[model samples]
Target: MKYDVIVMGAGHNGLVAAAYLAKAGKRVLMLEAADEIGGATASVRAFKEYDALLSRYSYLVALLPDQIIQDLGLNFETISREVSSFTPYKKEGKDFGLHISRVWDKETEDSFIELTGSAHEGKAWQEFYSEVEKFAQKMAPTFLEPLRTRREMKTLIGQDSTWEYLVEKPMAEVIQSKFKDDLVRGVVLTDALIGTFASAQSIQSNICFLYHLMGNGTGEWKVPRGGMISLVNELERIVQSAGVEIRTDAEVTQVSTDSVGVRVQTKKGDSFTAEFLLSNAAPAHLDRIRGKKSESALSGSQIKINMLLRTLPRLKSGADSRRAFSGTFHINESYSELEDAYVTAAKGEIPKHAPSEMYCHTLSDPSILSEELAQQGYHTLTLFGLHTPAELFETDPESSKKIAVQRCIDALNSYLIDPLESVLAKNSDGSLCIETKSPLDLEKDVRLPGGNIFHRDLTFPFKEEGDAQIWGVETDDPRIFICGAGAQRGGGVSGIPGHNAAMAVLAKG
Candidate 1:
């Protein structure tokens, strides 16, 4: 059946595109390869270890366009998360709590300023976020929402100055020049890896944090009250509510665009046709289909890992530390250490001492499970091992998986100064809770490119306004449009990519 639009992959971006179009009275049909929707934004209950809604997406509410939430009636599906990140750094033998969440009220701010102890710490926190709040204010509405031409973008950000200000100066250099403390610099530099496959040392690694920074237009990251998946479920409802049809287990095999429009062939011998098509899958996956120019824009791949724990980590902050689940525990021995890990991964080898970013949102929201597991002390943990070399699994996927999964256990043990005593249990194998899931796994499942989360090496430095990606609205083809994280503004849970992509199409009218 011919449709107004066909969204492939049903990832958050796909769903976002479909919903927006459908909301505008367009007939949109969303399809997924998996039995359930949500590409990376999905929750996998197939494994008991991951039964609860662990974060396949980020918890930042800042970058998400609030208009979509209100317009689509999303607040009913998603709960507001209150916890912000608290990174604990061990100095010498003592542990320090970096309470990253900003308490909105003046009274709480004063109390926190006092609790922070050092004047520098308090001011640094305030200052960094203050700048972020400023730039990010321009990020979403003015930057993220609109789909414009290169000339239009240049005019908006200022042609000569914007490139020099945003792209030319890499994020790493910004940290070295701006911040004094290595610890503070370390914390801020880590933001660079949010959606990029860049090492902190990469020419412009920290630039990805622009989206991270912008996400909280006000510079505050609140977790969803239930878990990260709550956002996905809510997004799912938005798609459903818009009367957009979604089908899981319907893997798309190929896409062919022509004078007759687009035909999406599924793995199960089913073909869906549409006047306009948007692929929320990774760009690498899209490459396998019948498209050339559209597939070249993406970059990089990733390795994802998730862990379920019996209790909050026992850190130097104290065995029962309130900071255990404050946000995420980024285990980095030193700045050089993290830089080296990224180097090794870039060469296609998982580092023995790879720096890990553990997003422990489960602790922030005690109710990760549907209900039952929440009653138990079972908390979910997201251990993101970025820059894992795709070649590591070339000969032995199992070995790489084992090492990749165990690194979290080993890293956690090192951080807490105690071994976990074999508490790691796999969800499916009943061995360990750590699982080695990568961009390859995602690509195999949904057909995204190189398993690159943002569909390719999403470098903001390269997003020139005239570029199809910069605006993320228009596609090379007349009717075909580029939406989703793979499009312009790139990854994170922000539906801006899809939303803006559709707007570009609708605006053509």
Candidate 2:
């Protein structure tokens, strides 16, 4: 039997790609190494006496097209909206809320200037930021549309700009140049490194900042009501409705290709053949499998930790009790303190300073998360942070992975937590209290390398225009395309890559 397309790993992108293909009247097959979908856009069942929100609202929804939501008829409760967040700052008996609302714009801007004495400099900061925002708003279309063809992107840029012009300029310089205040500069620079491995000072991170603004999951993030998994059931409905086959516990172990197209060898020796293939599995997993297709064109990966807590934390004098613990909490106490954390991370060691996290997925829409927990009568939390150098795991990991985690928690206390005595330890190693999971742990289970969520770094060289970069989705093989985060525009709940890959095969095949 022949298939018009075979999509591997039913991740958000892969599902979207397959669904679109089937909708266009193509025979689409989506395979998953695991029994479930929704990769990092996932929720774990509680084993301990605590609570957890079924779905996190500060989701990768920004990358999702508004029309896609409407067309899918996915549950309306699955999509709710409210104001986004508050970055709490309490130090030296002072408490403040870096409210993420547009209303807080004036106060937030004023507080930073006053805190850093940036107002004494000039009005240049005001003019520069306005321009940056305007430029970002204009480029919104490029971000919303998936890159299907070089010709399509060419229209967006002029022939005059050089490749270096696109990359060489640093994002830190862009923000700092406008504002002489170091504190204000650091605050603006925080946006640059949010979902990346690069520091504010790192190269090409300015682009990462651009994408961060795109998601803007700000304004009280929301979860699709009922349960986060309701999204899976809805998507599954669409897939089945569109005639896409479903399989669970049906893990693909090998992928082979020839003049006859492709053969997906499953662990049970069950064989799946198709004319075209798209993989939603992590790049790390797909790259390490013992097969021809296992050589995923991926370079490196990242480490992640998700937790469910019994109760929220308490901050001392400088802390804001009422500060909205909405989505993500930024824990930078000082400039050198933030840099020291990154410097330590570069050395494959955790910094002994506040490494930035008090983040709860609750900020998106805390009441929803709270209500969900109340229904189950337990308190839950999901915390995400970045540590480890870009290529830290390039070589094999030494010793057990637990040592590295301890170092990450230690790094948090150096500055952010006062006296180091007040810090609440809630499963510091991600093992004692909660079930620990990472890209490395998932490798044996799903056959991924370092268990990287995106499967490749979206730092640079991939998202830039006029470049023939093959980071994730773009490949040279006739019937090949990447559907997971390791593909184009990686690592988010957005299903753009999957959607784009299907459209490409539909147009070219």
Candidate 3:
């Protein structure tokens, strides 16, 4: 078969790329290795007996550009959380927490004062984020355009102090200097470490932090109306409507490119040729398929736990369970502890106290549950344990996974008035309604190379001086391009890479 473009994965990014190309009158074929699509953005009924749908992998919507949704006319929607985050702690023999709202309010101000022993920290928090908001407002729109040089992006942002701390220096310096409280510092730092195995001092953390906050200008992590799958299904609908051909269970095993065009061979021995090929798979995976040396990257360093709870666990802090669980709940994730966990994990040992955070998706949108389940007060909790890298599970994977899961549970229980296990829904077989995905499991299930969620370490969303690439999606071969998370500015649930790659191909004609 021949096509104007062949997208080598039916992941959401591939779907987005195909939708744009087909809408532009190109003949595009999208092939998926898996039996179904969505990649890490899938939502599934983890428990067979329950009617609850859980976002099995990536949960929140942050980096996806609103322009893509508008351009593609996607019917998907995301709802903002009423609360931002609640971090519980034990201080001087008393249990308390810091609660913040999505929009600042007096109650949030009181909580910050109570937690930090004054209103000064909260004031600093506002000032720091306000500056970041300025930077985001300037930079968010640039993702869909051709790559800007670092100096040019800095100039465009036009905030020298903001750029100095966020771009030039390590994130740790600003985090520490801005927030005096340890827990407050940790809360700020968590954004830098999601799925990324890096210390606060690493410039890598700065890149991760930038992407986390630059989404849609506001950087609010919203819940998809149904689940993560809603975005995929909508994109699937758009691509189909645009007349893009799709093939599941067709894994592209080899890719060859020449001046004329590109050719790919699937695992089933099926072949296809295209004037241009876009890789929606990781760059490392693409390199292997193209018979080139793959580059090394940090292994994915987080464990994802999905649970169906009979009731939301009450916090020892005495905050409203509804408010606490609705937003991000931090456990054992203080600044010092996060760095310590990284040091321990870097040495190939699971942290004795694994730092984890969880939120109740059902709190934001109960529509994912059946009427009976919702009426019964059942909710779904998704927990992510950080710093448990793939290397830690290399020996006795199952045993190590069990240990990591238990550590996360223990950490959560420390601040809960009711133990998490007791509130968990049970299956007909009496097994707990919960599951954990180690980094190894992600690689096996989704091919996220060592479970690195961003496909590799994320790069600054710009080009270097004297770089020749226009769209930042180009590879060494003109006929080949990256249309996935491996592309520059192509991390998270964002479809920027797909849009850019399509534009790159269109420009050639």
Candidate 4:
């Protein structure tokens, strides 16, 4: 069938693009390789025996702009986490922790002072994030607009020193020079490394860090009230109402662009023709299908572990479990440990003490659990193991997965007064209600191309000098565009790429 636009994936981004185009009176057809949609933004009943719906991948919502929500009239909502993060550590045989509130408070200040032995690091923390917040405010408005060159963006931001440290210099240098405490630096640096596998000294980390902090101007990571799927469901509703035709399990096997239009053939023998095509698939995946050599990118380097805990575990630091697990729970993620883990993973070995972070979604919003389960004190724990690149599991996924999961458990146990296993909910088969996804597993399941969640390395949001790119969603072929994480200024759950791609197509009119 001939269409105005053929979206080659029904993930959230594709849906966003399709919805926008369809609403503008363009005929759009959305296709998905999987039986369902949502892509990494999906939420599923990972533990079937349980009544909880877990955001199987990409749990938090930080980058989604309110503009998209309002424009699309989406009913989706994200709940803010009161506690920002909790990092537990043992100093000279005494257990302690640093607890930071979402908004600056005495508890957060006191916690910082207690850990760093003064207000110096706390002051640095406030000043650093305050600068970032200002920078984010300036950058956020430009996300949905055309690509801005580095010079243009810097001028627009108007924070020369902040831009120099944040954009020009490596993240490691700024982080090391700004914060004195290793744990504090690690906490701050974690934003730069989430889903990205790069050393702090690498420019790649700088890009990731920028995206992490620049989300919606505040960079606040919030939990989707009804799991990640709620956002997808709202997008689905918008697209369907806008007359977007969606076909599941319609994987595009071949894509060819001509002067007239683009042609697509699916694995199911279905054919489609469109004036323009938008790919929500990773660029590497699209390149493979288009018969082009894919670009080199770092393999996905984080492990996702989801668990249904019977109850939250008590922390060794004596902080309230409800509070500690409510926010990002850092385990063995000290700055030195993070660099060491990266070094180990780079050498093709999972770090013996793999750094990970955990959070309890149910704590922030109990709606994901059934009334019975919520009343029974059930909670969900999500663990993300860093620096465990896909290559570590290439030879033996099973063996490596076991080792990686064990390392995460061991690390968490060290900081917990109550053992994790003791608090885990059990399945009907006598198995614990826990699931793990290695980088390799993600590739097999979601086609993430080497399991890199950001789809290749993330790029700096702005363009270099003399670039002709407009929306940053443009491709070599005028009739095609990338509307996925592979696009510049893409990555995370943000709909910027999708929105930009739609605007690009609309602008062509």
- Full-model lDDT for every candidate: 0.63, 0.54, 0.93, 0.93
Per-residue lDDT tens digits of candidate 4, residues 266-361? 999988998999999999998889888887999999999999999888888889999988999999899999999999999989899889998999
Instruction: Give per-residue lDDT, candidate 3, residue 139.
Output: 97
Candidate 3, residues 1-509, lDDT tens digits: the string is 35999999988899899999999999999989999998999999999999998999999998899999999999999999999999999899999998989899998999999988899989999999999999999999999999999999999999999999999999999999999998999999999999899999999999999999999998899999999999999999999988889999999999987778888999999999999999999999999988899879998999999999999888888899999989998888899999999999999899988898899999989999999999999999999999999999998999999999999998899898899889999999999999999999999999999999999989999989999989889998889999999899998899999999999999988
What lDDT would candidate 3 get against the real structure? Answer: 0.93
RMSD of 2: 5.1
RMSD of 4: 0.8
Q: Give model 3 RMSD, 1 decimal.
A: 0.8
- Of 2 and 3, the candidate ranking higher by TM-score: 3
lDDT by residue (tens digit), candidate 1, 97-153: 455544444433543444444456456656656665655565446544444554554
Model 3: ten consecutive residues of lowest lDDT:
254-263
Candidate 1 error regions (>4 Å):
49-51, 56-62, 76-83, 93-99, 104-118, 148-166, 201-203, 291-302, 370-372, 421-430, 461-471
What is the Å distance of residue 106 in model 3 from its true position? 1.0
TM-score of 3: 0.99
- Model 2 scores a C-alpha lDDT of 0.54
Give stretches of model 2 more than 4 Å off.
48-60, 76-102, 118-129, 143-167, 181-183, 216-228, 283-303, 317-322, 333-335, 362-378, 389-439, 442-448, 459-472
